[model samples]
Target: MTNHWLFWGFWVMANALASFMWGSIVLSATPAAFAGMLLGIVVFILVYGTLDAYLIKQNLSRWHDALRRSVYIKAGLQLMNVFLAFGWPASPELWAGIISVGITQDRLGIAQNHYPFGFALLNTLLTGAILSLMVAALTAIIFFIRKKHESR
Candidate 1:
């Protein structure tokens, strides 16, 4: 249970860091604007990470057992994760947009600028999916190492 919490906590922290850095780099956000962005991102990460971690942890037990017995199943699962990665982006993007409204108004004192929803959506989805796939690839490498170690 503690480990589960820790896992999710780290995941949330990593996400928060990524969001903050990305926002800073792309938007050249002021400190206050970045704070607002970070606040929204942290909220999204907390909620999403907790739920995702719970599901993954539960499913991982079964996966681990099966993976230990069959390389084919392990490879297949990793392949599916490439698609599962697509589901991760929308919530954070939505939450960030919503939260940024208040933050921009209050802190930046900037008038809200309208962005086309479709363009933003497509951008977020593509970036998120690509990042997620990168993570999946790293995970596959770790699994490979573990498998190799176990066989020795």
Candidate 2:
């Protein structure tokens, strides 16, 4: 349950960040903007989902090393899901659906959107940091909780 929450939270944060990044880079509608947004979404899913899954798997393995091998395989499956589905950009709805699948497969929700961009490059940098931090915090919290529960 906790894992689910963490995963969704991370996905939501990543989604929002990707949108913000693309929005800042290409404000007006152009082929470049469309392509950039697609690329951004792909990168975001790969990086954030892979890292979070790895961390969770590591924590889970600590409880039962014998289960580690299977856990690793499951991680690969999850990674594939994110890469194949969540990475695609057919439409905003499709993207959102894929991201939701990634989150729910593990059990999780979208984090609060914090668009910190105000003006210039600073806006982009700040917004990116805020989004990254939001996802990181959720990931860390889930790992911590899992560790605590396992330790018991």
Candidate 3:
């Protein structure tokens, strides 16, 4: 915790790595979708693993400040997933993001084999938001679990 570089560096790395790999990790549809969702949760945990540790280390009366800071870090990290559209190997599977929401199609017309910048950007934002909410819930759950354990 004393080493600022180490803390922030790992935090970024973990989130980036998760975002970079999240889309590609989903295998298929139907019954397998459940497994894929489970895998997605795993990725969220990977992103949040260090964050939870870092927040626990801070031991402040209010964890909201740390949560806010982490969401910003996550959003920034999501930007790197732009490569997803170029078939960078991590493109999100959400091929139908609403254009009005600033997300274009996963790619242009078939045979074109290209992805809109907005597609990746929207996926990035959506996932980042989901991750923030999920991790916040996780943080709370973890806090209560820890409190209960400590009381014992």
Among all candidates shown, the one with the greatest TM-score: 1
**RMSD after CA superposition, every candidate:** 11.9, 13.3, 12.7
> For residues 1-152, what per-residue lDDT tens digits would candidate 2 score against the true structure?
46744654555444454445445443444554345445444454555556546656777544333223322332232333344366554333234333433443334332213211112223233333444554455545555677788799
lDDT of each: 0.45, 0.42, 0.46
Error of 1 at 77 (Å): 24
Q: Where does the lowest 10-residue lDDT sum fall in candidate 2?
A: 110-119
Candidates sorted by TM-score, best first: 1, 3, 2
Q: Candidate 3 on 40-148: residue-level lDDT in tens?
A: 4454445555665675687753464445464455446456467767867433223212221232233433111233333344444555555566446655666566667
The lDDT-based order of candidates, best leading, equals: 3, 1, 2
Off by over 4 Å in 3: 22-115
Task: Check candidate 2 and list the clashing pairs.
Answer: 4-106, 4-107, 4-108, 5-107, 5-108
User: In candidate 2, how many Å is residue 96 off?
Assistant: 19
The TM-score values for the models, in the order shown, are: 0.41, 0.37, 0.39
